[model samples]
Target: METPVRSARRESAPLRSTLVAIGLTIFGLLGAAIATLPAVLVDPMLAKGVAAASIEGQTLYMILNFVGMALAGAIYLAATGRGWSYVDFRLPSTTGWIYVLVGMGASIAFLFVVNIVVQLLSLPAAESEVVAIVGQDQTMILIMIGIVVFFNAPAEEFLFRNVVQKRLYEAFTRMQSVLLASTIFALVHFPMYVALADSIAATLTSLAIMFGGAIIFGTLYVKTRNLVVPIAAHAALNAFQFGVLYLAIEYNVEGVGTSPSAIVGILPSLPP
Candidate 1:
């Protein structure tokens, strides 16, 4: 007989548990709907193109979809006698941090390669919608950090890896479960791209990137059996991307005819 951990790592989830997870994901969808209520009720209609691109709107959307649903899922799972830790979800440890660092490194490489492929394919490479919403505002940047790091990252890992992948593994092999869950994860992001992409091909290409990211995060979860590993990795990647964007937009480090102050910012300030 397999030990609990061994079975967890290998077994197919029960039908009832799987159903519950699917339902919880639905509730997460509802949260997304509610998040956009403000835009929905207004004359402008916040479905995607307009409200979805505002900093305030995006924050609400992320909070509802990530944080709101995350809490509900936790409660529901606990009621069903499967607390997060029961699913191998817990805070990171010293070793866990190491895995997160490694995961981040691998994720960066993965995204870099994916971006290259996307550009080569003549597909949209930037999530410009996100950048447009964030703009050059410092406050918006900080809020984005919170959303990406504290809410969106962990929330996604919790849902796709801890819940979806875990339950899927109950019936499928580990690899199959990861692949399936990653595909679903990628698909969920489809709507986000649809409004912003210039063409369907661009949206599809963005989905491909999401698919790749999902696979990377899912693999980390399976290998370590720790949610924090993937969460930190996801958060770290978001942080790095946003941080780079900040430096680029704020300082314009590489723009033509760069200003003296901008150049000075890059160089040593030297003692007064």
Candidate 2:
């Protein structure tokens, strides 16, 4: 039988872990907000010097956004006394390969459905302030896609699937954790669309679309019990988004009377 003191300590361990997890989650959220400040607040200063259509500026904005969130994830791991295990990034088993296909296929289907929905409903089809304000030269679009697929997507997976959902799983059902994390994920991204939101309904529509995608990604993570599954799938989603955008630019797939930004806004979807 355990001693009284020993039994007390055993029970206390979970409480300690819960406390630490909660604190770290809050820190991660604040850190993410801080990280966005550069692009959200400071980038306007730099944009003035560069040409309105400079690809370099848009790339820089994305890089800064990703680095901030990724950095927050790293900080959360360090503060919580967790390591790669927090991220669960180990080489998955042979069977785990199936999940990769699962994520990509689901993402493709979601995008197709989303694209159809956008067309069916004549919604506000104007690009967000971020895209309209910065610039995207055709030469750098592929580069943008490469960064998004490799860095941006993985960084988000680490932050959301690995850190946020992983911690929440200990306190909630798998589905609960997925929906909660996905909701936060969607909300955090609102800054990207906030300026372009003409009304509450339009904003809600964008948020709902993103939340749905996050659910798919989160579900994939839960299914495989591996971060790589969601990461790969997220990258595939981003790849498709970029490919669509590039194709639009190349083919000038704009509705009559619509600006390039308007076409991008109305079609498939823009990166969020």
TM-score on alpha carbons, each prediction: 0.74, 0.75
* Model 2 worst lDDT window (10 residues): 260-269
lDDT of 1 by residue, 143-235 (tens): 767777887787777767887788777677787878887776666656656655667876777667777777888888888889889988988
**Alpha carbon lDDT of each predicted model:** 0.63, 0.64
Model 1 lDDT-worst window of ten: 263-272
Q: Using lDDT, give the best candidate's number.
A: 2
Residue pairs in steric clash, candidate 1?
11-170, 12-170, 12-171, 13-170
Tens-digit per-residue lDDT, 129-161, candidate 2: 334433455566577677767667887788878
Clashes per model (N, Cα, C within 3 A) = 4, 0
Alpha-carbon shift of residue 99 in model 2 (angstroms): 1.7
